[model samples]
Target: MLSFSRTRSPGRNTSPLAGGMDYLEPKRKSNVLGRLILIVSLTALCITMLKNAPSFTSPTSFSRSQEGVTHVLVTGGAGYIGSHAALRLLKDSYRVTIVDNLSRGNLGAVKVLQGLFPEAGRLQFIYADLGDAKAVILHIPKILLYEVDKIFSENAFDAVMHFAAVAYVGESTLDPLKYYHNITSNTLVVLEAVARHKVKKFIYSSTCATYGEPDKMPIVEVTPQVPINPYGKAKKMAEDMILDFSKNSDMAVMILRYFNVIGSDPEGRLGEAPKPELREHGRISGACFDAARGVIPGLQVKGTDYKTGDGTCVRDYIDVTDLVDAHVKALEKAKPRNVGIYNVGTGKGRSVKEFVEACKKATGVDIQVDFLPRRPGDYAEVYSDPAKILRDLNWSARFTNLQESLEVAWKWQKSHPHGYASS
Candidate 1:
């Protein structure tokens, strides 16, 4: 009996059966406390995760009131083509937000647009550089801060029209890294913002230079993209990224491979206003206008030894009006999860010599032409078929007459001798 049972002490269970139960009680209580602590920790973790989670719902889908009204974000909207495109979008009753760094673009163009569409929500202009990965806080008597991500986050954009880039071929050849950073890297930044915000429609302003010197004439959409210059190569790289991204997304994308862009807003409110330094590597139209205005002594035709008609480089020139029209059609016809690639030209090629003659007639000036040898990265000839765009979007170039297009542009040049600076 003495070995089997121990004497009971105060506040202790000495019996063998009772002792076992008593020993397990503290452990059971400890297990219950541990479970409560674990449950509390788990609940706190769940709450934090829920608080920090990103919303998958599209910003555009937040309101049924905005069903039919489409708000578009136009990058580089202060430049020539971009400004014209913004004007067209505004005229079509679509809300437009124009973002530009004013690097190659002009603040005067933005002012002209603001004057035209002074109605508050019809148009908004944001000064920003897409290449900068961080927030750009610009102070111009007024503190303005913005970034690509912030732009998409604040605005419920239905479509994005990306037209920002350093587009000079010669410049691109000299500074390949600048072209890559501006064209390719900046495009990736904008695309990332577009994807994060779940934007549905995208219109990329591409270049026919992406085709390099194709083996065939009148480049179709399916032509092999064998870009030669840094400009073309960078653009092609951006196109590949867009194509790959579209493959896995439901975004509607339209890549318009522009051959040559000329002319301006026919209303004389907007025009091509390249900086004085860019005249050498700027558009042929700008050079022609400069020579006509006596800003330059003569038009220096860079390439005149190519194996083409007139021994000059040939290109297809499309009017800004028709080009903007094509963009609108692409925007309207865009379908989810579909990509449309179109050669946006008049389906005809014009030699540089022929362009000079047309410019002479348009400006009423005997433009002295100095036919120089072929320049670096010069293509023999490049034009577009444009049949695919017509068949798909029911759009074709109406401003086919090069002389008439030049005349319209000349009128604006004559009036704005100093471009927007005249205003």
Candidate 2:
């Protein structure tokens, strides 16, 4: 269902809901949780990796060592989750290096980090575009392997957190091949570079969208993956590819499948913004492909009347802080295993209205919403069965419920409406 070229849009533009992918609808449905979750998924697809590659953390990005501190490199560290994790690692006393393309992420996020951690003694930032695969692969591996002048040698990094990806659902749908190229293939470039560098501990930001709509509620890590959209499918492909690499490579991989990752850094430091409104990822796609997938007018509803509390959709919402904390904890893990999968979410569920209410409470704004129709290829209600993660990671959501996280997000939004760009 595509039909256009990939030429860049002139400026800011908002389209119809096209289901929950494009915009939010005002009306409520019978399946409260179901509809609610779909709504949250929109942002989730942006924040973490519901549409993106789930944000990851490098334990030793800056870690205490008998000698001094472990060097840590963060790809996409300028972005929301990456910046937050990067800042936390630096604060915890790890020497951190951030490499960002500055497409989806704001350079401002890195500025906040500079002011936050102060002292460039332990932190380094690089503006590297991964889009040029050959140049990137050749350049990064050399840095990781030999330590060069432009690439800061002498610092042996203990690990690398891969958070770089071109993430955008609607855009992905419009041009599936492009999303696959970056989110899936660009990651391959990172993996290859890391493999060549021999970085031991590598944490990945995978996503729950890999599972798509599940037959059972509280979907577990073992849920059958039948991604409905190009974005979800791309994530699934990335997970599979990473797993394969782990099968052969000696990389220590922890694959975290994030649910709805909401809220800010809690310390009022980092938050999510995309290339679209708050900003969505300025997605990369071939121009011919863009013209191929013509945008459908009005809206495209996948499914409205489901058997849930709300007719819309329901999703598991987790605090961004909780997610980053998990990353910092997983770093101490020292073992060679196939990519381990973990669901990051409060096993609890929340409706769209519930999330909105919390946002309203936090921001003290009743943001306008217009209801459209149901979206195809979407789940009725999907929450995480994070039991396995709790048992293994020994980490649970301490951020309370959806309302609590939303309040924190709202608070951050109120203080910095346009995100840290204002600051």
Candidate 3:
């Protein structure tokens, strides 16, 4: 499993042929042929764009404003992290509209969230795919538009917290194109929608995998991003695009690069429960949950030959509640023309054996483990230097005591043995 808190090509700004053309200028007495070729290429490109202009300029509208509540859109709000963030938003008196296609998210998660705030009237769900522009537009209320302009002025969205994407690193590695389509391409669609609507605040759900395998123990925001997998690569591409979009627009963006996020919501209202059959098998906590329920034969601990103290991979695990707190604070701090990037973690490291032990303590069940060879792309150790976020957002991990987190997770697993189907 690749750690989350999930790449630049060289010479991207200058054309590859520009320098070569200049170098050959002295040798070539006449350059008229080159100039003609350039002109022909530009003319053809313009004609093609003109022919496809209408498809790019689809009309879409969305609007929702109440007297006393701040409106927000949380994509993928039925999933693990998104659901927690949405619940926090509603608790904080913000009116939230959750948009998820429910491909990976469970309707039961949304139902559980709604149950938490039955009287608040602050949460709503829209089932739509982020990758489909028309699907997203149809769900929003129509109140404004422009002909042939991909403007989102009618949506009236104050901020958008995007978390809708395929997050499995193994799958990403197996099919890089799928990761690109799900993570990068979908992000562009959301960006276009956000930019069109003049939505100023954007909180991106990024991963620590963007840091790849850094040489340093605690990675800072300034660390070099050398992603080793397609999942991280896809996220890095989205982060770059978001930063580029913020440069010319009024949008304020915050890229929250998360470390290993484990545990359920402390209150037991929500937890990490991906559909069992389609669940990504890389998460240690999820593996423990399955073992506790006999969902799998037992847990498999991959890689026990690392340079760490326990000769196993080490990661900083932050509670989902604390992770969502950082999001809420980032939303409050967002202002026009401002862009911020922060690492979200507990600033500590725990080995695979240690985590498994904690899970055993939490569930009071014997967890069988089979030591296996290192999985490809598994780093020896990784954590965070979260001083920046603590200093900037006045936030720190409060529910990060590993045992406490595991206990809560056990409760969720016990209560919903089949993950919402148990409801």
Give the clash count for model 3: 12
What is the C-alpha RMSD, rounded to one decimal, of candidate 1?
9.5
Q: What's model 2's TM-score?
A: 0.73
* Tens digits of lDDT, candidate 3, 1-423: 877430223423335655633333333535777788899999999988986795444432234455555678898999888998998998898878788889888899899878876764467777766664454378742221231122234345688999888887667777788789789988887887787667768999999989899988789999999999899999999999999888898788999999888888777778777876655445788888898888887899889999999998999999988899999999998878999899999999999999999999999989899999987666788899999998988988998799988898889889988788888
- For candidate 2, write residues 116-143 as lDDT tens digits: 7777457878887665545456776444
The list of candidate 3 runs beyond 4 A from truth reads 1-62, 66-68, 118-121, 132-155, 280-282
Q: Write the per-residue lDDT of candidate 1 for residues 265-372, one digit (tens) a residue.
A: 878899999988888899999999999999999999887778898888999999999999999999999999999999999999999989999999999999998877
Q: Cα lDDT of model 2 overall?
A: 0.68
Best by TM-score: 1
Q: What is the TM-score of each candidate against the true structure?
A: 0.82, 0.73, 0.80
Query: Residue 368's C-alpha lDDT in candidate 1?
Result: 90
Off by over 4 Å in 1: 1-65, 133-146
